[model samples]
Target: MSKDFLEHKAFVELFDLHYGNLVGFVYGYVRDEEVAKDIVHDTFLTFWNNRKRLDLSYSAKSYLFTLAQNYALNYLRHLRVVEVNEREVSQLLEAASDELAEYDERYARVEEKLAQLPDKQREVFLKCVVEEKKYQEVADELDVSINTIKKHMSRALKFLRDELQGESILLFILSNR
Candidate 1:
């Protein structure tokens, strides 16, 4: 229609023609396709906004390349912060997983020690230590004499204490239980 409208349309066409190439160029620096696309999009938006002030004598391609470069640098700087944050998060997650694995190993060792006990002793120990039963209650439930329950409990504690004594940490864990 009008000269101004035609000029604007031509500018828009030029942007579309170079958009892919600009994105690819920025991607070379940024090493990320999405960031490259974003930088290129911002560059075009900035160019469009400054269209009226553009110097027609200067090459449009050169102007676009400069804009793309500046945008890519800014994107890279922003990515540095994101990268640091991601590394910190990964480290924290690894530490948490390591702690959980240690706890699981300790629990497994305690289970293994329990398995080593005589069947009657193991049952009595579980009822007293794990089930939190009193000696008289455990004796009534198991239909054993109170003295027999006490003897089983004494043997279970002695076996666990001796097996875990070398590892003070395990002793603390067992004592707390």
Candidate 2:
């Protein structure tokens, strides 16, 4: 071993002397026994790996404690980041759930109002508006004149607008067609 580095026996002795104290020190910051122990072990691993860089001016025990403290602080910071992300994800999910429920309720209301229309009016509305068919196409499909198709479509729109007044979702649905 280099003069700057501790031998295996000396390092092992150092670990045995300070391991319990380092764990206790980290536990004071982290408040978890397993996490504190893990941090202490990692600190020792880092110390062993960088043994050649050891500065004799500083005590080995002090260096080990400082490394353990840093590890504990990093773990705590990671936990806080995870908590914030979890909260944001939960809020987004809740908002989406609320939006879905509102959409379902509005759609049910539109379906209820559609059921109140006469069969021909409902059929014309579905074909021309919901199915995006042209008036001439709807007329040909229904074996009716285009003028009759136009009248049915007009009456259906007027009735739905009047019944679904003050409903922005219905307005958007109809206006988009």
Candidate 3:
């Protein structure tokens, strides 16, 4: 199957057949209705993109469900990580004696942490998170798709969290300044 093949009636037929049940199944893992739908849609898009490489031996339903499962698991994992990070950060902030010193230290730590990212990830992280550039603006400036910029930002954040784990000051400077 090719991209052109995905345009064929059979693909829409397959989508109609599988999408609802798959979304319901995905909702079980993802909990959030909107995110579950998005995951299913993204899985279908992936299937369309890799339609040429997709194995005929396996059921498309199974393939899509598997993709949804993987996507949901990853989403859950990232959500868990973010929750933990935020919780720890709140605790740390509460522990701080002076807000000014804490913010100043966090500003310096963010710089040091960002320096640890790869060039592209670093650039994406700084532009999007630090400079607070819009994703579209960063994508335009970097000459990449918004999706590519988002991927770089995700990787950069995960890398920063892993490297800066257990630090008193959060890796990111959460203040508007």
| lDDT of candidates 1 onward, in order | 0.87, 0.86, 0.83
Question: If scored against the real structure, what TM-score would every candidate get?
Answer: 0.64, 0.88, 0.52
**After superposition, candidate 3 runs with Cα above 4 Å error:** 1-7, 97-177
RMSD of 3: 23.9
Q: Which candidate is the best by lDDT?
A: 1
Give the alpha carbon lDDT tens digit for every residue of 8-105 in model 1. 89878998899989999999999999988988989988988998898969989999999999989887888899999999999999999999898888
Q: Give residue 147's lDDT in candidate 2 (0 to 100).
A: 98
- Per-residue CA lDDT of model 3 for 34-67, tens digit only, reads 9999999999899989988989699888898899
Q: Model 3, clash count? A: 0
Candidate 1 TM-score versus the reference? 0.64
Quote the positional error of residue 16 for candidate 2 in Å: 1.1
Worst 10 residues of 2 by lDDT: 168-177
| Candidate 2 lDDT for residue 84 | 100
RMSD of each: 4.7, 2.7, 23.9
TM-score of 3: 0.52
